[model samples]
Target: MTADERMAAARASGPPAPGERPSIAPAGRLGSLLVSSGQTAVGADGRLIAEGRVGAEIDLAEARRCAWQCTLNVLDAVRADVGGLERIASTVRLTVYVAGVPEFTDQHLVADAATECLLRVLGPEVGRHARAAIGVAALPTGSPVEVEAVFELA
Candidate 1:
């Protein structure tokens, strides 16, 4: 089903069934956590299609998963929020931040996870943007990764 359709169905079913949601990681800073809710936009089913969050605590493997999922979540939101994905004129930029220990400096690797995901989804269009992957002491919600993008809308 289309993302919108999937969202609608989810909404019809009401909040996720037990265990359907990814557990919230411990809040590190800013008091209560501020997650993306994974849903960038409401699909036709009236369900918000949240694919991932800004900061989550997970193993490196889970961090990688979160990177991919977060990018997809943004892409899905972009499509749903801006009318449709086809309307995307150009990908102007993507900025990814990874929270890690002082010893962990492979920020580029984590950033690529999201970059590659966007490339697979946006095709050559992904080539037209600037990207940065930086390591930070912490993210808003102890989220392992946070991704932001600037797309030229058609």
Candidate 2:
């Protein structure tokens, strides 16, 4: 799906639960770059889509889905910040955080879900970017995953 299509779908799905603010500035402009705050796997219902640590209460598959949800939240924030996704030139950086138990080393794989969603909605050239996947002891709101990004404005 294109970014517009993805945005339309998210709108049709409905806004997040009322009164729940984004964890940080959805997106902010610093010169030509748009820096996005970290987003968790919050659903439209205003609930964490997946909770607990990977390799523990949350499995890889579910964590991957949560990663995708976080990506959508990021996109929503980007749209609100830039006028439209068309104004985005290309992704500059992506950072994925996975709450995981000790010895859980597949953090990069979990992060791929967010990258895949970006590519699917924004196209390959624009979505491709440098990335880092981190494993952490815990995450905010108990979410299994969180995603943050930076993009260049066209």
Candidate 3:
């Protein structure tokens, strides 16, 4: 969606409850996160950018399916929050966190599921940023995967 449309849509969705915040705070110093955890809108240089989450206990699946669902939902939430797909400036970065068992060291391979999903949704622009796939004991909503993005506004 265009930045304006996305912003407007984001304003409409309001924000998720504070308790619903995803544990997306990657270890980095990005000048204080623009939005807090679980927040659908984030501010960067005063610009309000929006993101969304999708998943509940009912959405969980095996690793591969979970990964695909996560990426799709991330884009779905983005589109819903932002509006249409014609206004995106760039995808700055994406971080995917998966809840897996101790033997799930294959986290990177599973992460590919998310990247592929983004490629289909965002096209070549998906190649513009760095990414990471991490394994954890649990996700905010017990989801198998939770994806988040950093976007550049037009």
Q: Which portions of model 1 miss their true places by more than 4 Å?
A: 1-59, 126-128
| lDDT (Cα atoms) of all candidates against the true structure | 0.62, 0.93, 0.55
Sliding window of 10 residues with minimal summed lDDT for model 2: 18-27
**lDDT, candidate 1, 11-85, per-residue tens:** 888786665766643211122212222222233455433323323334466566657766776776666555666
Pairs in steric clash, model 3: 1-84, 1-85, 1-87, 2-87, 6-82, 21-38
Off by over 4 Å in 2: 1-23
Question: Between the candidate structures 1 and 2, which one is better when assessed by lDDT?
Answer: 2
lDDT of 3 at 114: 67
Tens digits of lDDT, candidate 3, 1-154: 8999999998999988876865554222234222112221223333222221223222223555666665555555555545654445666777777666665566676677667766777787643556888777776434566667675544
Q: Please report how far candidate 3 places residue 98 from its true position, in Å.
A: 1.1
Q: Ten-residue segment with the worst summed lDDT in candidate 3?
A: 33-42
Candidate 2, 1-154: lDDT as tens digits: 9999999999898878978775666778999999898999999999998789999999989999999999999999999988899988999999999999998999999999999999999999999999999999999889989999999999
